[model samples]
Target chain A: MAEKKVYEKTLGVMPDVISGFCPGCMHGTVHKLVGEVVQELGMLDKLVRVEGVGCCGLGQQFVSHDVIIAAHGRACAVATGVKRCSPESLVYTYQGDGDLASIGLDETVSAANRGENFTVIFINNGIYGMTGGQMAPTTLIGMKATTAPFGRKVEEHGYPMHVCELLSQLKTPQFLVRTAVDTPQNVIKTRKYIKQAFQNQIDGKGFSLVEVVTSCPTNWGYTAKEALTFLREKMFEEFPLGVYRDKDKEEA
Target chain B: MAERVFMKGCEAIAEAGVRAGCRFFAGYPITPQNEIPEYFARRMPEVGGVFVQGESEVASVNMLYGAAATGTPAMSSSSSCGISLYSEGVSYCASARLPVVYVNVQRGGPGIGAIQPAQQDYLQATKASGNGGFRMIVLAPATVQECVDMVYEAFELAQRDNNPVLVLTDGVIGTMMEPVVLPPMKTDEDIKAMKAKFADKACTGHEPCKQHFCFPGSVGTGQEIANKEAEKMYATWDKDVRVEKYLTDDAEIIFAAYGISARISRAVVKQLRAEGIKAGMIRPITVSPFPYEAFSSLDFNQVKGILDVEMSIPAQMRWDIDHAVQGRCPINECRRSGGQLLTNDQVLEGARQLIKEVL
Candidate 1:
């Protein structure tokens, strides 16, 4: 008799393959969660992802869905086109903080305001990881990035942006939430939010976004364990994790 | 025969796009071309199509990228500054080999110079549309009827070559109205069949396909190979070069023009002929595959000189004329800029001056 298999491949994900992200990078974990939710929801066949630039763009190689890579900062606009052309297909965009909140802010806000029927998974890591740890739009105050060698100052570098709160002011978005992947419980919660966002799209509710506050260990100069600790203690102090808006619950 | 209707140039082009089976249109409002998106917004729903007024020209072109990647016929329209914003997405479409159509009802510009008609973007459109030094099929229509015809033909050529096509009209023709015989509307079945032919390459998310519909940066040597293939495709476009020749069989003076400038040149050519000047006009209908053969095949022994007419100062299209003529005859520029229109009298006077100097 063969030895009992301890693990099986997640549906809609490549089997036993390593992603190109750094060792402590949370992009792989987020990609796994997205794959698991897409598989659990039975949308593997109908899922189309518009991949953004940077480490977030590497999700295409780890997932088994048809992915169209968008130019840096244009993922939401690209997703809008894909969704409008094929309304029956499930569409989503995976973007980084730099791609989503900085360069692509107009596309993000406009798509949310217009209530485009799709999902956006925005990974907010507070620093530009692929471009060598530069300051990102979501970088916290006093954070030390390559661009901010002396730590971010309020006079020069401005404060971190709460994207969920910024977008919740619009009345059209169906769901807006901020979660993290630093802990097992928070990862589970992040999965729930991701699932809800996709379900909202499937239910034809409206635009939904799940902003995942992740850690960049290489950029942060911390080990994997220290990155989780910093996320829990320091990052959470600035970006408290919770649902900012839920139109479905409000309507109910 | 389809019934003729008096329509604005922009509206007629929009209708022709719909009839050509373009079901997706994404555009941002700009001078002289806003009527295009406005018309699509009103007509797309009736034809079971999708229309989006994007946040900006940047978003509009990327939206076309997404729709076109699905192998659906998609289009966008803008003026000068907006086209500048769209340059990146246009280059992406060319590199990815996605056949999309964009119309530039040009305005004067280095940066929002004026809202009125100008042909200053000729170099930008034909020479360097975007980075990576790619080429697009650029069509310049002198009349509203030609606008409708070229727009209809542009969709077919875009799909046939799997490349981006630009309908490079100007503010004058974009706002002008005339009677045009519209093409027959493509049936729903026809559109479906056309899309089905691209099913193998389309990213409809129905099955797992190996082709990555993304930027070509990570493909290593594959990027160079794709560039070579694109270069070959561009070489084959020589047969598709089109121009309207008016009595160049035996002439001593020739006028080279396109778009609104061509209209003035046509009148100038007729006036010169009536005065027994042996003058003619060569109007380029397709500007990108710049009709070099038209100049190369001219009888140099009888030709006096060529007057390059345009609505741009410093003469943009004159460069192509210079390259084509290759010192066979002296090339002179008859041009106006900054929202100024070239008159027939001005062109005739310029032609006579060149004729007197050369002969």
Candidate 2:
């Protein structure tokens, strides 16, 4: 009973229910962060979330806020529309690696370039979680998946897209930070940055992104605990974590 | 009162959107309909509005969905291939029942099939372009002037029904220049009057409205509220189907067409009248609520033959006409596809052939 009570407080506004995500999924952790931020900011009434296809696609379903499910690879564009149309509504998008990096690259870069006033929570879990472990754009070089059984060869398949570095080139996008939630200490920092991104929108600042370096235990062929160690050791080396852009401080 | 001016069909559509009190325009440029964005790029700013050249058609319609979600009269324009990219947003708008206007300047399809005009997207525009059992009110205009005129009706019907409305014009109607009269522009005072009465529809939290009167929690779980909303959409579509009839009182054959093809059919009707043969044309302005009753009102006993003028090889609209007639008259289809438009001469020749075979 005490353990249940402790977990209850952490969820904030996330309803307690069985979700489509696999057990011990990092999506649950990210959703909790999103819900806590919404509750803390008092934006539950005005929140308009656009969810895309993936494991995190179901993030909106767990939260107690107004939500709109966008077509795959189109969440950012939809959120851009929503924000421009209702400048007052707090708009955000929850997308996965495949939806953001591969199919919706144009929408992502352009929205960032134009400085669309919205928040984007990108879940980068190496493999495509929803469609069975396919080769994602972020699939580490020489990593095996269903599509790339031998491994993602750098010479043949090209290098993984450094979306953070690509987005950092854009002059706009007020806040862009990449963080991981594998550790409890890192999870707290991830929550802080995610909240700050939404707060930037509330402050009428431009586009903000919180790219979460998450885990795919089921697809990555590892136990949930081992996946956390994999992210810390293998993934962080390839995609480093930290703030890529902070325009507010840059101007100062 | 209607004012007349020589204008390209695409320009007329942009101008009509303005007259209809559309304050938001988001679109990406595509062939055969690029003029629409250019027109709005200049005109929207002049009218104290926002015009975004979206990164892509997907972005544009999502932008449209955003604007429409706020109850603003918003629209996007695209040619055939670009319109295909907008299908996802269209489906969401349908599910949400968000009122928006989409202008598809029809071009050849299957994948960027030339920039020339064609009526290949008839089925796509009329059927549910989105998910579930959702439908869009498709308005097919026959002329540049009607492109402007029908857009106004499209906006009106969409808002009144709280559903998405499509203005289906071919590349011919979009590119061809013709004389048109712009509707009277709404003044600041007019907007103020509308705002005073209907401001709640635009944004929430107006004077702390009751929870029951707010945004719906999900899609289709509510009872009386959802039913009442759906009933309003259905009733509005039923009443807004517009059709034009020509010389149908004592005609032996009737021609069915819409958009650019309808214009050609009208010319064929005139030629048949001159040749001492009784022929008429029935033009459907609203393709979705399809004026079945309007076409059925024609005396089929006297109508010995029917011809469908189309720009598709498979005879799309002719199917609708056949359903309307219910095997009452001998029907034939005359069509040209892959970016080819039927000429007045070609349509008349088809009519003449049909008349000889039947009469």
- Each candidate: what lDDT? 0.89, 0.81
TM-score of the second chain for every model: 0.97, 0.91
The candidate scoring highest on lDDT is 1
Poorest lDDT segment (10 consecutive residues) of candidate 1 chain A? A8-17
Per-residue lDDT of B18-75 in model 2, one digit per residue for the tens?
8788878999989899998899999987887678899888888877876666556788
Off by over 4 Å in 2: A1-21, A38-45, A149-151, A202-204, B1-4, B128-133, B186-236, B294-298
Q: Write the per-residue lDDT of candidate 1 for residues A125-177, one digit (tens) a residue.
A: 89999899999988988899999999998899788888999999998999999
Residue-by-residue lDDT tens digits, candidate 2, A45-132:
6766777777766665455555566667877887776677578888888898899989888889999999988999999988899889
TM-scores, each model vs. reference: 0.98, 0.88
| Per-residue lDDT over B239-352 for candidate 1, one digit per residue giving the tens place of the 0 to 100 score | 889998999988899999999999989898988899988988899989999998899888899998999999999899999988888998899999998878888789888988
Docking class of 1: medium
Error of 1 at A10 (Å): 1.5
The local lDDT score (0 to 100) that residue B10 gets in candidate 1 is 95
Kept native contacts, fraction for each prediction: 0.56, 0.30
